[model samples]
Target: MTAEIVRTIPGAQKRTNDPEGMRKKVLDVAEASFQEKGYHGSSLGDLMAAAGVSGGALHHHFPTKKALGLAVIDERVAEAVAKTWIGPVLAAASARDGVRLVFEAAADELEKQGFVRGCPLNNLAHELSLADPDFRAALARIFRAWREAIAEKVRADQQNGGEKGIDPERFAALVIATYSGAMSMAKTAQEATVLRQCLAALPVSGQPAA
Candidate 1:
């Protein structure tokens, strides 16, 4: 089932008997479990229990754990990147400000949530990159897409003579790497200060007044 289908169904929890509902519920719970605990650390039994679905139900939909993980990556995780990063960056008035705003909003969220967990993509990348090629490829695609989104904005900024000094590709790579590292540090320390410090150090020039 598509993430769009999962999202459109109201009262999903109350419709467990329906095939689509069961599938959506399983994906929802599995994504949360995988995010909280590493993929290998999260077992099918735990997922079934958390999702309030029987083993038969889960098997009927996913058939195997790997299939479920891939679905979460392709659907939920991809959708998250689109909603949180790509869409906002595309819509903002200035690409540089768009990138900064994303980090600033992330810092605020980290502070509000007490910085318990790091970025979902970063967490999965660390855990699964060496374990499975499929997982690694899926994650790499997301990372490339994210970097390209930012790079496109940087290129636009450069063309407009806003961010003229740096190479757009290099700058985009730096932004993603720095943000990921800062999130890891924040997760380790259980503090948001690391993110704020990183954001503060970001280069900005010719930025229009907000």
Candidate 2:
């Protein structure tokens, strides 16, 4: 289920009244509203209403619906974006552990957010990718970052005694693609189990040569 709306926490900024904080609040509301109602379907009034802001406030922050959507994508990239592979990849003392931990952590994060498997990058890409070149490029950057971050972690593992004599890059791709597919399924089913199963299916690496 989508999270229940509450007063903006203002953690990202000093005050709820701050311009940046208020802008983020607008994006947060827009994301939920967009998820409920697609970009083409959702009216500016809907986002404004969800944010509990006047047209003046929304315009002051985002002058147009496309601008608001862009802000939403930016916020997703900076925070609350669901490529959880980063944390576990860094946590691993070993390469094999890094692979498992990264995928599993991804699953755990998805479940924690409850039923929403909304990856902001994927959400916008699936919708506006063909229509808007700018939107497509913005989301593509995040997607690239997500993959590169995992790839870097695996590369780091090689020097750190993470695993001995294995193809770290290929393994990174497997883990990333695995989690991405799992997240997509979870998004479709609206269930966390899909993610849990995907991670669980990952082969435990670092095994003795068979």
**Backbone N/Cα/C clashes per model:** 0, 1
Can you give the TM-score per candidate against the true fold?
Answer: 0.86, 0.74
Q: What TM-score does model 1 achieve against the real structure?
A: 0.86
Error of model 2, residue 108, in angstroms: 4.3
- Model 2: ten consecutive residues of lowest lDDT: 201-210
Task: Report the C-alpha lDDT of model 1 over 113-134, residue by residue, as the tens digit.
Answer: 7746888888888888898899
Global local distance difference test of model 2 = 0.69
Best by lDDT: 1
Q: Candidate 2 regions off by >4 Å? A: 1-21, 95-99, 105-114, 165-168, 205-210
Off by over 4 Å in 1: 1-20, 205-210
Colliding residue pairs in candidate 1 = none
